[model samples]
Target: MPLQAHVVAPSRTAHVLEIIKGAILSGDLAAGSPLVETDLALQLGVSKTPVREALKTLEGTGLVVIRPYLGATVREMSYEDAAAVYDMRLLLEPEAVRRTVAAGGRLSAAERALERAREADGGVARSAANREFHRALYEGCGNPLLVASLDGLRDQTSLVSVAAWARRASWETEAAEHEEILGAAREGRADEAADLVRRHVAAFLDRLPKQDIDPAPPSP
Candidate 1:
């Protein structure tokens, strides 16, 4: 059965994108699931124009894959792809967080995001909160270019994290790690916070299934 996403008009494409992005993160639209325009349009009570535009945007986010003639499907990350994403994060995020911590950056937002993630029962909610928490950690690094680079990776990171959650149901462990990272940052232990961030990233990567995902379906 096709997934149904409800949306209202007026900048409907952005609304549609968020709705479908939430579905994908929450596993309502599982990896490799097809996104048929007609079905989505009918289900959403809109014309195919908005759906098409939203899909094209999602494709750029690395959450949706589009083939020449195969239409669109939720993206599937190979083991190498996952590793590379994590590796880039390992090289970038920890250092950024360290700079933020060293600069005595504000961290009230990170604390709030941590609480939200702990309270969230859905993967989508947790994913959004998690993104916010990490953003708070690094956005204060005083380097806009570095922050921008990290922002570029945020969507891919969310997809990878959701996949990791599917393999291991205990996000509490990750939450605990976040607590440690934040604690160090708040205490002005910049190096410790940076190292903790590194460990946290590596730990999540280790938790991923030790194999590449199946190839994406040509037509879902």
Candidate 2:
């Protein structure tokens, strides 16, 4: 009998990206932690090439930084960076919500995401669901550029360990606020939806604890 050759699946760059992203979002990889390709490749059960590519993709999303000589490391979300992200959200989200309501957009996806958030226990799952809820709300805004910008801000904020914050903070208020915003949008109350979104974001920023950036140690 002839020996059978095993078939290998093609490179899974997306899979690698997701694993690394999950690690970062789950707080397994802290901010400023060095991303050594060899270590990551071994940990992920893939080659260094895939890990390198994934890191580059993560860099584009502002989750990883590739310095000229220092290689890749998780990006730190300083207080200033977080404040700027919140400010941008405050400026853009209101209009996005208003536009979505004016267009009579369906809230099915947003509703599902909100439900997921409500059901999820605190941590990465809840944080992810919360992000999905916001994404779904603004996705029908009829402006791809605006949506993309908001997505980038959301990703950057995630890198700041929003899940960790969720674990520590009381999320009941956030859920209630989301329900009110969703109701306003579903009822086609454009101005009210917009105002509610603005207030929701502002309140979140107000509740965030002030903290200095503590950079992670480099990987050995």
Candidate 3:
């Protein structure tokens, strides 16, 4: 079955870009998978122009790569690329969490976060929900730039995490780690919470395949 792009407006190419980007981040579209315009246009019921525009937008963001004759594919993550994104997250998100926790008030969202982490489906959905939960924890940090940058980093890290999730045998443990971080945050232990997140992120990055591991390159 072909996937349809849900277009809400004709002028908002960014909206379409977001949907496709979400698809990529959530692991609905795997790395190295080709994006066919005609099929996407037909599926989305939108004109080819918007589809093209959305692809261009993603290409610019480095989420999708466009080639001359081969066309567009989701950008693949090498061990180095994956490690860099996660390492950045390890450096940045803890600060955001600490700042938010220090400025503490209500953490009603944390309850929902725990639930989502526990119940969301394995693999991509779990990772997506986990990312959202982390964002919710830091939404009160009061820095718009931090929030936006962390959001992008989270999306990039997710791409690598999803790929790892699909290939690894112990993928089920990610959800449990999410809950541990959320629990620390919910308790107002900003330092401990940040430490937990740092460790959680670092552990995954440590396991990433080296450049020489050679993923059985996806079929053409």
- Model 3 local distance difference test score: 0.75
**How well is each residue in 1-220 modelled by candidate 1, as lDDT tens digits?**
4556577767789888887887887778888899999988888878899989999988987889999898999887777888888899999999999999999999999999999999998877898899999999999999999999899888888888777676666588999999999999889999999999999999888877665243444785
Number of backbone-clashing residue pairs for each candidate, in the order shown? 0, 0, 2
Q: Model 2: per-residue lDDT, tens digit, 85-179?
A: 88999989899979988999889999999989988875678778888998888888999999999998877766544633643464678889999
Model 2 lDDT-worst window of ten: 1-10
The digit string of per-residue lDDT tens for model 3 on 87-202 reads 77887888888888878845777667667767766666677677777788777788999988887776666677667766673445656777787778778898998888788778
Structural RMSD, model 1 = 3.0
Clashing pairs in 2: none
Candidate 1 vs candidate 2: the TM-score winner is: 1
Candidates ranked by lDDT: 1, 2, 3
Q: Which window of ten consecutive residues has the lowest lDDT sum in model 1?
A: 209-218
For all predictions, the C-alpha RMSD in Å is 3.0, 5.8, 3.2
Q: Local distance difference test, per candidate?
A: 0.87, 0.80, 0.75
